[model samples]
Target: MEKSVAPDNNNLAHSYNHIGGVYMNIREYSKALSSHEKALKFYEKNLPPNHPDLTTCYNNIGSVFYSMGQYSKARSSYEKALEILETANPSNHNDLATCYNNIGAMYYHTGNYSEALLFYEKALKMIEKFLPPNHNNLAHSYNNIGGVYMNMREYSKALLFHEKALNIYENTLPANHPDLATCYNNIGSMCYSMGEYSKALSFCEKALEIREKTLPPNHPSSASPVVPQNTNKNNTYLLAASWTIAVTVAALVFMPKFRELNCTSAYEGGMKAVIWTDVLQALVMLVGLLSAIIQGLIVLGGFGPTFSIASKGGRIQFDNISIDPRVRHTVWSLLIGSTFNGLSIYGFNQTQIQRYMCVRTTRGAAQALFINAVGSAFIILSSCLIGIIIYAYYADCDPYTAKFISAIDQIFPYFVMEVFSNIPGLPGVFLACIFSGSLSTISSGLNSLAAVIIEDVYKGLMRGQLSDERQGFISKIFSIILGAVVMLLTYVVSHLEPILNAATSLFGALQGPIMGVFFLGFFFPRANHRGCLVGFVSGVALPLWMLVGSQITKNQRKSERLPLFTTNCALPINETITFSSPVRSDPLLDLYSVSYLWYSPIAVSTVLLVGLIVSYLTRPLKPHAVDPKLIIPIDDVFCCYLPKSVRHWLRCGVDHENYLNERVCTEFIE
Candidate 1:
């Protein structure tokens, strides 16, 4: 038989390299390394020393090593790639940028910040020289440099470069693009670090909004957007929203100048003053609510009579805890699910964390948390009572039927207007309180967003330090942009379902997975970042899928509409308003019908379960490698009491006790 001609070495090398790329994406690091090494061997034998194929093979190998946490090996591979690139291409070429960036990353991971900065700056300059001003490559370069500066604690330089990246992304990418969201998120983090909480919040929200639009809800990004699609044909709404956004943006952009020319006293208020101002704002709200309640009581006689009238409407019952998860609320959902929901909201929310961090001591944070819980309870109870009172007054005479309010949500506002109508300036005072409350909430959120952008995204990327004045200047400008972004979201919210309902559902849907990740980090030492990330994505997707399905089921529903009361009772008997009931029952899909209350628990449970499984399946972090501080100290106590069988089943390693002991020792030493 004739000897079979061996496949061309170059072709074989290309094939192996292509295979390695696929393996790398799927995170099969060992397989990826094997394929890339084979490619490199073949390339070396068949191609010239400085061939581009050799450069690619070396770069791929470096990336695989980096992913494997083999920093030294990654650096060596990257250096080889850089050598090949320098020989094969000119000094100013974009290919050199990639090698430089890779090497910079290697140095960054290895704690050689100075070398990282040098290499990153070199890469940035090289790319800037060849790439267009707004090129995405330039954005990448700017972002990398910004990140380095942020790590070095040079806030102003970081902000400058990050803003450059963000500006470029804004100019070149779509509004909802994921890359733009990344930039926004980074800037938000940076602002957060600098203590500009409101601005940080606004920028973070912008990032979230963008991510929701671009990435699929199940993506291992942030809590996913529940809305299925980004584009809508509501041109009129879009146009109106665009106009509002423009005005808001203009106002925010010019706010600092306006402050300079006008309210020079604003920045003079220190943290203590800010806290006092918040207290005053809270008092204004309490006064408004108390005044409204008093007026309501006077108008509706005593509590007993008002309660009797409302009891007839039958809207204040809460005994609906059926096994079906699709029910809106149940005793089971409220007690159990709400705990998870609350934990998710308070435990891991960056906004809450930012506030807690402002406290001078851990004890202060604890006290603040306790106060917040108590205050929240009081507010909720008071609000609920007010609602009951309103229902009692309106039960016999529906406001919608009487044309007293256009929407159900407006009933309270209308009642406020009616009650304070006789009292001169009282209504205005109440309205002002409401306005101030809104302003405070929005301002806080915006500041927080700006902080996150600056701290997380921009701070580690720049080359120099920033003065306090310059930092404040950047913060103010950033806050304006974020505020405008929020205004745009308001428009989107208006076009959606009732804001409160949508917001509640969205929160429940998103919070579960986030909380799960937090618990994984704090409670499960075996859980690696990859597993948590994967589980988070899976967890988010499950609830999102259910929510989307539920919405669809609701839209397709054909059944008797819930009864609406009419004014016919007050009118002549002959003029009674009668509604025809539909014959079909609106049967909901099982998963879709699951109560919204259960979403948090389901999400939390799913993430935890999935994360545990995935962590075990993957190369979990060795007990010795995990930082003890990251794990909850109390968790070890719980683990210690577990049955031997349970421990064995969990592969709670034989050295687990020693691991915890070692960690404690490390903590003591540190």
Candidate 2:
């Protein structure tokens, strides 16, 4: 009794739909768009224009446009989607909610707050009647409504929705569940906006604590840590704070002209010495990191974002432990961001993978991952202690107030600049270390981006065997081109701390929407492709709206609006800060009090909620209709976590012990 199925128009269209969804999630927008177009053509030819599937096709197109930030085009496509869905679906059916949410989001993006609220309300009412009260989808509507209020600076209204969302989520989901924590953090942020520092700090700390408990010790958990408080009045904290100020002024005047004066004679000699030294130290950094950090800086000129500190004769510090989330920084953020950053640069990165794979066995590779996770933990803690000690140095020997470099990220670099500049070959070594960092990072990105393009984008358009040799050649070309791009980027990225903040935050802007889509794919079995597609579009649109709003806010007097993206200290860090006396952090950095770490959880949850509501009101693709391979994992995507022993067995039938040798491997010194 085998049921017969044919690869007809429905099947072909279905295949293209799933493929498009896959590409869309990965940020391969162009390919995703093309795939959706192919599906649309097949649907139009095979089915009537008003077919339910055609509505989905329109919605899919809208989604791709939304991701690409083509708002007008997205709206047009979504309107067509609504027209088809209305024609095919009865009023009050749950499916229309998808269209409602998306269209609402388009309005939201256009800054039509009232219209956005109306549409969101409409979607919320429909879901209220049809879904369970505690359903995640229901909570999403609350969050969405809250978001509109938040944008309008209606703190009271926003807080109302945030609390409602949390009530449902905290009771139903696990404590470590990221969504619940986000609601807490979001609410905390709302309080901060209202000048309720104690309340705001309370919520932010709660969210952060949850994250710290749940995430891998090496992963970025809840990102918003309570900012430390500033204590002054003839104390050590005041002196360190003074040193930071001094460095800030001095660097502003002298360094800019020094580069102008020194020119090429200084450049070539330094680059040669630095690059070679950096490679060796960069390798050494994998093990004896603290010593390497100190020595590497010795080779470089100064301690700053662009150089080392000893070279500059200055330092940065922190006073007491600040539990205030509204403060600019916390132990959690530095540690969490560092952890996540390390994971990202190492995990799924081809350059790191290449190095590990070169080892004889899977066990060797796994050992590397293991060593990395464990070693990195210690390294992170060490960095924290180092920051503490150096700041102590500033307090002890109050350096001149004119020593602060370009931006805060420069603190470390300035330290390097100080340590390395005076020595003969030291600056060369430090420069080498910097180049190696750039190389490793850029090389990994080159391989990853090329693989994504070739595998997802080019596979359908061109034909050839994708042999390892072919991949190698393509990767090399990618590496070269990407290398040039990095150089250009590096040249333009001079204000290191601000650029670092912006670059990481730029990634922040993407994580929310992408993670939301992935969650739907993995867990929401009932969510068909149409719902998936529409939801994703809405999810991204919300953040893009946030970004646009931030840009517009930058136009207003800083005093008028609720501080959104503007970099206010998450807490006041100066010797004195109050409602009247605000601590001015690095004016150059574009971040507000909220760190980029919060973005991952917040962004992911937003996409999921928006996407789910939209999908619930739209058509769900038939699971069996899509290729099993497309839906299932053929290999662990987290292949990076392979244990050293098992990995060795797979790679080469090599003999290896499960236990790592306890003996220290070497006494080598850089």
Off by more than 4 A, model 2: 1-281, 284-327, 330-367, 396-404, 419-424, 464-471, 495-499, 530-593, 622-670
| lDDT of prediction 2 | 0.56
Tens-place lDDT digits, model 1, residues 1-670? 0134354447777878889999987666789999999888888887889888788888789778755545446657777888877777765388887767766765554456688789888888888788889888888878877777877888788888889998998999888876677677667667777766566667778877876666544222333211111223364588689879978986889657645544322133323333544666788888888888877877777787777766655556677657655556668877887787788778877667767888999999999999989987987788878887776655444555433344666777766765665586787668867876776566566666666777766676764786777766666777778878878888766654445556666777787899988877776778887889899998899988877776656533322122234321121111111112223434446667676777888888888899989998998888667655556643345665877667644543334556568878998999
The root-mean-square deviation over C-alpha atoms between each candidate and the true structure, in angstroms, is 27.7, 26.6
lDDT string for model 2 (211-323, tens) is 78775432212222322111122445677797799788868976565455432111222222233333444574443335435654333322453223322323333452465
| Native-to-model Cα distance after best TM-score fit, residue 215 in candidate 2, in Å | 48
The local distance difference test score of each candidate is 0.68, 0.56
What local lDDT score does residue 26 receive in model 2, on the 0 to 100 scale? Answer: 66
Estimate TM-scores for all models: 0.54, 0.40
**Candidate 2 clash figure, as a count:** 91
Positional deviation of 136 in candidate 1, in angstroms? 73
